[model samples]
Target: MLNDLGGQGAISRAADFIVIGAGTVGLPISVLLARKTGATVICLETGGLRQEEDTHPLNEVVQQGMFYKGASHGRFRCLGGTSMRWGGALIPFQNSDLCNAHWPISLDELTPFIDDVERLFSLEPGPYSDVSFPFELGGTHVNRLAKWPEFRKRNVAALLDADVAAAANLQVWLNAHVVKIKTQTEGVRLEAVSPNGDRLAISGRKLIVAAGAIETTRLALLIDRQNNGAVSALTSALGHNFTDHISAEVAEIVASETALLNKIVGFRFGAAGSMRNIRFELAPQAEARRHLPPGFCHIGFEVEKPGGFDVLREIFRNVQRRKSPPPRVIFDLIANTPWLARAMWWRLVNKRLLFPAHSRLIVHAVVEQLPSPNNRITLSDTCCDRFGLPLAEINWRLSKEDKENVIETSELFRRTWRTSKFASLGVWKSIEPQQIWANIDNAEGIFHPTGSTRMGACPADGVVDKNLNLFGVANVQLLATSVLPTGGGANPTMMLLLLGMRCVNQHAAGSTPPKA
Candidate 1:
């Protein structure tokens, strides 16, 4: 059951498994271990049960190198973690991504866990790679599809609330911030503090750190320093190879054949209540031939009518947040009555999210960052958070090759559009590569921070091994986007969840928890 750390009295100080950061990765793994293994699992969350504006301060970091906006605005510390603010986009890693020699495990090794991930998310069992473009785009680009869960199911805490409550062996402690980790040869102990200055020490046979990428790396760096590298000699690579997806709006398209364009680029609702959207990317052959990093282009729409359905959405969000709509918001909603009515009819009756009539189409391109050691996260000597812990100092930047990947991918799409039948019916507002690259500052790092504390085959290259166990610490494992060796063009949340499940399952099978 969920309990606030401050209110819980005489709680168990030891458990079979201890998970830090009761967020997207932590919560599911905790429930799985409790239900499947019937072992006592305790989860510690840094934030309260609900999302709040005041919690934003806990996620703030100092920028030392390249400025990353996600360091300040992209993360959440609430119960559901960043999934509380997620858009529900589920994109799996491509086969090529797993077999790229960067990852220690291959596609076949990871395939067995995909169905489990789908089941956890309440999605239909199917292959994400099966969806492709009906027509080829000169064999240079391939099509990938991203599935979305229903709006109500987006927040993982809400999705798993019933299961969490039903799990008798699971205990979730909210407002329990882990400030330090103490490791021993046999196990690990976590020192957590509550908002009211109540301190709790929890010990377990095994500990999993599922904090988000940046925070996870920060904690690892701290542990390494505290232990004087006894934790892992590979701690040298702990903060290296930081990566995130780079995206920007590259062009505009005005299509006369709106139906055809919609069929190709519009959102498709599945019979099982999932929404799917297609993105175009470099094919494996083209990627190898060109020696370019992974990248993709997708279509976005700008509402033609003023305020359109967006105003209505804003009002709904405001109500959900328990805030009163401002006068301008109310006025916009009233002025867009006709558009709202049509949008509502399309949504409720047709089961489709409709773009306003005559919506202007925009082309956006995203590229996977080539992992670079220069982009990293380190501890700040000068700054500390409320808990007196060093704030994370992020040094992130896009290399010239990263910028070129975006330019080339965007240009490929522009060229494909020029040769396609839609070209005859539409006008394409294409931008030069130089112009697109110049404006790239507007879309740096789309909040998918990854590759810090990446996995490797040995301690020489990575902080963690294939099983996500820290190089020298056997009882402590890490399950976060930070452990991902490579960040593909797809979203990393689903992949991280899959890896988390695999880590727990492997740990459960390998040995029993030490006697408590």
Candidate 2:
């Protein structure tokens, strides 16, 4: 049940629970929370139902190479979050990502939630699972990527849009931009503004801020600012330790005969482009490790380049101008041989780009960034909202290990490509080591942007504990990308959805929702 906050006399009502940001992570979270014990869950968003914002600002941000100051990852002011046009590229975190002891819990802990998430999103399953565990144990690798014959098609009705809110104990406030959260003696209070000029002050028995990493940190800082001090405890760490996927694309032609080789290097292979085969693989040595430092769970793959350099450059320039870059990440497989892999460079780049029989299939990689305090999001006094909440000034950054992973992963695939049947396909060469760890200057934060207000078992190192409650705040839980202490180099929406489910069950289980 959702009501337009713009309607008169709507700001005085109260809800048992309040969730800000009704997009990707927040939508499912609201649903799960509401269903648990029939709690009244109220969600506040900045956009309305009549309006759709699937691909807002479809301008020329890529080609123009301009700055996307206020732009975000398909950031919707409307409801339904970015799922409306998310490309829905759902992939689960690798075992390495979900197994890190650095995390307060393990993938096993998130197992039940994963099933709920799959059920909620009505996600068509796919593959991936740890060898140590049985496929029936939890969200297995095979089940995750199980061929979803109807992959992109919707299979459930729970997935709603800006027009229709889900049916249940959940109440959505359309076009209500939540600005601040104040912890009152009785409960949590929220200050949300409507598009037409309405300041709704409502109280909730509990509060969750699943407003994406960037926004999550901003909200926390807003609370600290309103309290008359720097955003502290709950940890000044609220805005520190951020990580995002580091990605880059390179293109070239598949020298002849390579097509046959790719066929031999099958399995784990699929075609996204016409006749253009995309080969994705982990380092032959990329097995799960109990320890490899944090942020080590990452994936890399390449695609063949499709269009003219000028055409692509122009398109990218336009995308940059509009602050919306199309997925420039591409991949190609050629790691089978060492000598052949090195020779790949000579066959291509001789004043001509390399390409496969098909169009430009780019070889792309998703690398993880180690958590560092330097890559932080801080409040900007210069940019304040009408109600005095400080706007988020994200100093986007990355680490060196971030880049090495990409190179290593690519090289690993290169060696496999060389030894594989297609070792002599077209000319393939070494990845020129684009942007490596710490030098992160890719497309801002593409598919995955995580860790602003991370979750951990201990209060000293993180903002929210495993239960996802803010470390020093009482009854305040978070539901944003920041909840992920490390984003395991996979698309985050699926995992975020799973976490929301976990929170719902725990909150309803009489666990006394962790103290602030």
Candidate 3:
């Protein structure tokens, strides 16, 4: 039953298993455990029942080590977790990504869980129809991604309202923040605080910390501090190897060619109430020959607004004329002109009603970042959050090789586009690598954070073992993206869903809660 923790005075506080953060990973794990194993499960969510104005404070953290804007942003502190803002693009990792040497487990082990993830989400079967791109398109492959929130309901809401509704043994505790955890010989004790500053302690026979990348990593560091390095990995590497996809706009195609490219790009209606967006992945052969990491280019339409193109042309001409006018002057001139405003309005109306094509093709590149030990999250010495826990000081770093791979991948795409006769990029200027790299400071990290508590064969290399149990800590498990050893070019959502299923099945096998 989904009840507020404040009102659970009559119910049993102890449970057979405890799962933290009822987001994408936590929700499914709790449901599977309750129904499959018939174990009494308690799910703790620090966020409130729903999104409200005052809940943002709970998510506040101090930004250090490379200064990511998403450190405090792009994360939802509600029951559904970050899925509240998820775009629902579920792209699986390439097979090559699964074969990386760092992975203690192989791709074959994870293949069976694909069907389970699909069925759990109620996704239509055989929705991804393979559309092969032309052979001449050397750098990109034809791939598809289906949209989520099918039938106008969020995935988490649908799962709770349908799949988990009949699970009588599962208890969801909302607005319960776990501030400290103490591991005992038989079980784990968690101390959580409510929104009203009331403290509550809950115990479980087994515990899983699935509170996403940032929070989970923070908790691991806290545990190490509390236990005096007893629970932490030997190199004090609990919060190292932090990574996210580096997204950048590398180039733009001409306005007139947008319609032709749209035939090969963007999303289309699919069978079984699904939507498929064609993606052009860097071919494995191409990646090998060029020594490039996994990267893909997605084409999106950028509508030409009233004051944009004119300002660009004016700025270009100003450079030619040696006239140094501020950009604000040009914007003010366009904003104040009545005729220009009307022209922009007519263009908007025509595009909306007359089926007019887009103005430019915006090419976005999503690149895989190699795991570097220096790029990490550490505990802040001087800062703490509202809960008095040391804030996660993220030291996000991207190697020179990472940036160069993006540049090389973009260059390959430019060369591939030139050979395709279907579209013509007339009167276009090629954007240079340095130009794209110049904006690295402003480029926001993709919200997918991984590798802080990576999985490996032993604790010497990673925080968790192959089964995702933290080494030396027998009953504690991690089921979030933080346990991912590597971040591939594809979105991490679909792969994470599969991993969550694997954890439940393995944990349920002969696993029993501790005696009360």
Sorted on TM-score, best first, the list reads: 1, 3, 2
User: Which stretches of model 1 miss by more than 4 angstroms?
Assistant: 7-12, 129-133, 271-273, 287-290, 304-306, 315-337, 344-352, 422-425, 511-516
Model 3 lDDT per residue over 1-516, tens place: 776766544333788889988887787788888876778898988887666342377666666556676666767666767665556677677766766435888767877887777776666556443445433454455454544433333447444655556777888778788888887779988887776676667889999888888888888777677756766646445788888888778887664654344444545544344445656676655545345667677766565654444554355434322345575966656664764454346444422111123356677777877888888888888888777888888888777787877777677676666766534633234667677897554666888888898887877788888888877665788777878888876788877777888888886777666335
* Residue pairs with clashing backbones, model 3: none
Error of 3 at 335 (Å): 21
Using lDDT, rank the candidates from best to worst: 1, 3, 2
Give the candidate number with the greatest TM-score.
Answer: 1
Q: Write the per-residue lDDT of candidate 2 for residues 256-337, one digit (tens) a residue.
A: 7643433322123122210111224232134422223322212222434333333433444333223343444221122223
Report every candidate's CA lDDT.
Answer: 0.78, 0.55, 0.69
Residue 35 shift from truth in candidate 2, angstroms: 2.7
Query: Cα lDDT of model 1 overall?
Result: 0.78
The C-alpha TM-scores of every prediction are 0.92, 0.72, 0.83
State the displacement of the C-alpha of residue 128, model 1, in Å, after optimal TM-score superposition.
2.2
Error (Å) of candidate 1 at residue 150 is: 0.6
User: What is the model-wide C-alpha lDDT for candidate 3?
Assistant: 0.69
